[model samples]
Target chain A: MKKVRIGAGSGYAGDRIEPAIELLEKGNIDYLVFEALAERTIARENLDKLKDSSKGFNPLLEERMMRSLPIAKKKGIPIITNMGAANPESAGELICKIGEKLGLNNLKIAVIIGDDVMETINGYNTNLLETDEPLHTIEDKIESANAYLGADIIAKALTLGPDVVITGRVGDPSLFLAPMMHALNWSYDDYDKIGQGSVIGHLMECAGQITGGYFADPGYKDVPNLERLGFPICEVYEDGKAFITKVEASGGTVTTATCKEQMLYEIHDPSEYITPDCVVDFTNVTFKEVAKDKVEVIGGRAKPRTSTYKVSIGYRNGFIGEGQMSYGGPGAVSRAKLAGDIVKKRLSLRNVRTNHLQVDYIGIASLHQEASDWLENEPYEVRLRVAGITPQYDDAVKIGQEVETLLTNGPYGGAGDFKSVREIIAVLSILLPRDMVKTDIVIKELN
Target chain B: MKLREIAHCRAGDKGNTSNISVIPYDENHYEYLKQNLTIETVKAAFKDIVQGDIVRYDLPNIHAFNFVLYDALGGGVTTTLSMDIHGKSLSSIMCNINLPDIRD
Candidate 1:
């Protein structure tokens, strides 16, 4: 009959903390998790750490900890987060400092590390998961390499009875799964229970996503009160059966539609969802709308866990330069097309070396590219966007420069001309043997 | 009729690949989707953006079909020159697919 009410605090790093505050105040949850890290966030954090030794954790870590720490401590609810980004040790210290400022004494904070595998990565001749290319090809450009740690180590951190557990580059779902494993005392080798926990973690990891934040489509898939969207909560039982719901007074509805959408979101294979803990089979997963706002999730099968951990390698890929100019009036489409051509020709004349270039009429064929076609009635206005991927930073700037030239030189009635260039830190993945990487937890308690 | 009329979809990306899940508004339309939502139909619709293979996974228990498009995003979110790097808007495109009308 024992159950844990887990509340998803923040979905991503920059997610609003108000909903999380609501969860702590009204939800009466036992565990609160903040799934803050994204695929490229840690890499960007590593770059920050390179500049400043003390930097590299989530930018809003102080703000989040300052706001949530007192409430979570008062409620006796353990908090978990991947806000540590590239540096959990420093993040833990900062949290301790914030807790002291808040007058919170005896606040136990656990910082989990060892996801970074930059040193060990070079030793293995692993091939990139996406492409057949070996890791050696872009070794020089590597910025940060962190493996996706699973729930076992996180559960180990929980055994120490910490009020808050902060980690770097752990699997998004593992944050939620760890709490379940610790609370329910589930064995690591129990793939079935691990699979169920993984499903629950995956579903709750995105917070408001399952509660209609991204499910709104004007008339087709209408979600009400989205403006005040409430994050999701899972009332998970010891049996691994959980009810996905939200706070009653809050906005957003937790329905079967939203649950189904989130179940397969970002998942490649339905039956074979590979998490660090185990391989989940979501195909058999069932959602029953037992109530208006509560959907009962059941039946998530699984196989054994994989021996290797997926490491996300971030490296300097190139630079992307983009330029945009808007055109209006009766013949805007034609004018924009002409403007696009001018930018292309100008780039060629400037000898701008680019690996990939695209001249798109924004309103027409930008998103779908060749897949999109013109409408029957031509658009009265259009924005021409010229973007290119170049090896050198100077060449990237030239792409946008050419587009900027079209404001007066190439196209008529051009307005809102803009140009920007940014360095691309691309991410690639490789599988490293799990044994090669070791995770260590450092706990800091406010006395 | 359009797929949007009877079904809804959500698109998600991993590396260079994208997965779009199509779920029917009504459970009755599940069979209709399985029939008309063929690989060829999706391939033709996404011919421009998707450069790799398209595979569909069916989940009758949930009444949903997941379409996995490989090498979809120009190169992926970080490296791609395309404006919609994450391919988040690809769901809208999937909803725009044309479907045959069903008899009452």
Candidate 2:
């Protein structure tokens, strides 16, 4: 059976880098992927790029490339990643520099561009998926509008024989699927094969997620060797059959439970799980523990893709101002409550204009809020957190300022005061005609 | 018995929406959970936080129920003031639901 052993390098931007290096060193993988971009990451990166010409890619791009490039080059394995964020061209150039620094020459790095549709998306006058409002509603606030590119273009880049493929705002699964499409000679119209490959991509995209990174619940759902949770490796066959596993020496377990959790993560309707390439029917997908650390994944189907590509639109929503103060010893909850009251009243007295505000006791009600009435007794310690959304940065800063005042303003034993104000680059979605978003690859090599 | 006794769940988010998957620890408990863990039940448990509609999708082959709650994350991770922005902790809250004990 023609099979591809693909290693998941990093799940998110700040994910641990050691696991990827570990995979390259010992996993004997044919391909490696680092799925690093999140919804708002590229939007923020766009702002960064506007500030500096050379900025905008993933901050960890240099470090990740410096670490993974040499190993990937030496092992004759191609790498794919969306660490490019808002700048694939720059990212590809940086990778070439890193390769040259490591004395590796002729590293063909393919950079897939054209995901940015901000200039042209306005013409569509599309209704935002979340609010059903026209794009013009938040026109001034729009920072980025990148279409989710599919595996087709990425597979084309692979044919150009790039040592590494870097892309911006591509569908997460497409990074994994492209390798399969290129190696297995799968056609774009082969929805079944593409669907199956997408399933593998989705499972591997989150790296350690399927290998027990997020599955631990102590006694209830105990996972072994969690401290050093191993990233996942998918052994995919030509026929679309695949098995999820990890290296023998690595920590974490790959079982049906872990796979099941990751398979449904962020998925609303299993049957209509939409990706740029196809609509996967995850309802039929099944996981069976065929071995200790191997779980076979089977039965993924798909329908033809829609004519539209999903575009993640990022806009400047507002500024979030937050402040936190800790109170300890007996009656801590009461003290925290009093501290919250003071902040709330102080904000009101100051006439701080806020779109929304929340006062929470960290140890008690921050997570579940009113939903968590199950706390039968008062906690010995609690951290009071005051946060609010405001249009102006100055207004947002007041929230934190008020919380910091609780230390000297009353509430005895209050310590560990913290405050921060951050601009919210909120993301919404819209569907764009697939053809309207052009995609082309730029190849970079050492001099 | 509590739902946590027989089932484990994982929560994930997309925008302001959140999806919680409930999978039974024991294969036998799947049927019991499917019957009792209704949309109404899940909605009741999450009434305070979730502000939109809830839909339950049953995957018989996998023996899991995927409950997707709309407008659940206080306007999603980016804008929401929720501490657990991704609604990752909602899975634990989901597991805390009360369930009728099933005798062997």
List each candidate's DockQ score. 0.89, 0.91
Question: What digit string (tens of lDDT, one per residue) describes model 2 on residues A263-305?
Answer: 9999998999899999988877899999999999998889999
TM-score of each: 0.98, 0.99
Q: Give the DockQ-based CAPRI class for model 2.
A: high
Error of 2 at A366 (Å): 0.9
Supply candidate 2's per-residue lDDT for A304. 92
What is the C-alpha interface RMSD of model 2?
A: 0.7
In model 2, chain B matches the true chain B with a TM-score of 0.97
Clashing pairs in 1: A106-A446
lDDT of residue A291 for candidate 1: 94
